[model samples]
Target: MSEAAYQEKVLEVEPYGIEPIPREERHGRARQMFTIWFAINLNVVTWFTGFLGIEFGLSLKHAILAIIIGNLLGAAFLGLTSAVGPIAGQPLIPASKRAFGKIGVFGLSFLNLVNNIGWLAVNLVLAAMALQKILPLGYHSALLILTIATLLIAVYGYNFIHTFAHWMSIIIGILFIIMTVISVQNLPALLSQSAASNGEFNLGMFILAVAIAFSYQISYCPIGSDYSRYLPENTSGKKVWLASYLGALTVCIWLEILGTLTATLGMHAGPMDFFAKLMGVFTIPALITVILSIFPVNAMAIYSGGLAALAMGIPLKRWTSAIVCGGIGALLVSFGGGQLADTYKNFLLLLSYWIAPWLGVVLSDFFYYRSGLAQNSTTNGWAGITAFVIGVIVSVPFMSSVLYVGPLAEKYLGHADISYFLSLVVSALVYRVLLKFRSAAVPVKPLQFEE
Candidate 1:
């Protein structure tokens, strides 16, 4: 179960391929290809700040600072983790199989599935809320619209998801930009009216907001390699890094501006409310269009989640799993609860539990253990898994508000972000020590494609 032994085993290959490439020419330039994937996948409802931004009264400066910190951190991991795509020629779950082992796949797979389902629920809420505004449709009908839209695209699988996402991201970006420009043009007058408004904005809350934003995407870095796996092996690392970082940063910055401005204007309302206000100015059609933009993003959630399930030994095809899982997500909309507030908090906390630990493991294995060589499939690196578990355990105290030992610790540990940073160190140390105690006799090789 040592890291080296596990990697050596997983990378050992059979003399055959598992999933063969199609003979037909695929349609997509790398730029367009990853543009959409990165755009929609990166910007989830959490960016809107209806829950976080409006509640905290974060201003333009606060949002900017938060986004800058988040993007720098997020982009760094994106570059490091995204390199797995061209190298592995597989999705995230498969690539993760190297680190988690076949059994570890179950936890990762389930978490991914749950995450996608949660996103689907949130989108359903957005779509339903938008529909409620424009049409005579009640919440039920709107949920139906959300479900039908998600189901249609999700059935076609990854190729369609990628292509559709590319186009949608472009369109969504343009529309969102128009809205932001209008809002900014009108912001000065609006802010002056509320210049004497009473609202407390502190630096600590702003940092937490930024941490939350960054934490949302940080968790997905482990999965970034999954997307990159399909890329051409010769794709430049610099290009891959640049494409991902630029694509994500562009979208994140725009949304933060939009979300923050909307928050300030509708200081009396929520994020969804601000979106509604802008929609009214743009007209009903514009609102529907923006709401519909959720489809491409949801498609990604389902696709990534399904793949994660498969890697965990699910006994279903990708399409089948997507349908069933997505349907379950659609069903959650009936409750009219997206858990946006709690979900954002949990995601931030999970940054410590999942992302930081995984990042630590990957970096540790890659640089110190693997020496940049690929790892084998069957190798069970219990050291890494143990590290992850310990990371989660140690992170729990910081995650819970009730576990505070002091005011300073309460402030620091009360938030979920502490999980990510704390887990990174704990997991890395646990992994290092475990490797020393449990040695294995094998040489780690390149990642072996499943046959």
Candidate 2:
């Protein structure tokens, strides 16, 4: 069947995978990017990310500054990369093939698949935790229910996901606004409250906070274009970029600040518990909102993970992939008995360990290296892969994790984890310089696909 005909018939199923989305299948406004990102970022996991800095002993004022700076930087990358989707008409993995070779991108795709599944598990666990608190279901049952709910939405594919995000953005946005207002009523007093002794100003903690916040956004880099590829090719790149940036930034800052305020007020419970404490009799509503908000976020993760698996040459339909990925995440949540706070922190840091370098290579290749090369030529896969390895190696000594703090991390910068920064800078510079020495081979024939 013609790709367009297939797309039309399966309106609920995303027909195009690694192939460029046919122009006839592309029809959506740039503004939808805003709502999609906005809805996804409204997740409670984002709030928990903000609260990490407070746990690190940074004062509220400094932590907020780090959050702002980190989100701004991270959002820039997310926005720029998302703009590539419409022009390339492909998801992150396929788009990456332009810079990283067909073979090179597979390794990244495999890693991306793992990362997406990790994120899916984390989000499901958090939502399930909230639901368990609000309802009588056991934690395992709540995990199962949340995973199945998110999987169903993701299995319906792109159009349904977009539609779901649009409506959820409106609903959750209003509910959160109400929660924000209630929380803000006590903000003045919270602001005046002295920082916890652990919250004493510390440079190490400040940097760690920024890294965590930055990781939160950049972790989405692999999937940034997944949502935008369905938009028309003529869509204004600038508009798409701005809409995405504004949407994610607006929600992230608001929720992070709200999270910081909650932490400041001595709310040590999980995200929903924090909300329940603030809303009093409205706790049930607040709890429900928190639970429902995870749908778009986790759905995105599962959807993207499935796409990444396909990019890595896995043979499965998108819906089948979603089921497989969702099942894996549910299994982890059921058996992984670690405390939520510790698990979240470790996951965020681990996320940065890989993503920081990957972004560096991707941005450098796309903006600097590949832009100057011919459109259809074969890329020097080794250059990017080698550069990525070098970046990881350089990052190890600067990493700070519960697993192991690097020697350099403890010796310099007051034990702050600067691995993300170091890795990004090193990888970009290496890739850019390497590109000058390499030459693209002859134009390769395009893959034969119905699209």
- List lDDT for all candidates, in order: 0.59, 0.78
Question: After best superposition, candidate 2 residue 380: deviation in angstroms?
Answer: 5.3
True-structure lDDT of candidate 1: 0.59
Q: Candidate 2, residues 246-275: lDDT per residue as tens digits?
A: 989989988997888777777777566677
Error of 1 at 375 (Å): 3.4
Report the Cα lDDT for candidate 2.
0.78
Candidate 2: where are CA atoms >4 Å away? 1-3, 6-11, 195-200, 270-272, 336-348, 369-374, 441-451
Cα displacement (angstroms), candidate 2, residue 418, comes to 2.2
TM-scores, each model vs. reference:
0.81, 0.90
- In model 1, where is the ten-residue run with the lowest total lDDT? 1-10
47-151: candidate 1 lDDT, tens digit per residue: 464235444555556556777777677666666666556655555455555456766767766776677677667677776676677778877777777777777
Q: What is the C-alpha RMSD of each candidate to the true structure, in Å?
A: 7.1, 4.2
> In model 2, which range of ten residues has the least summed lDDT?
442-451
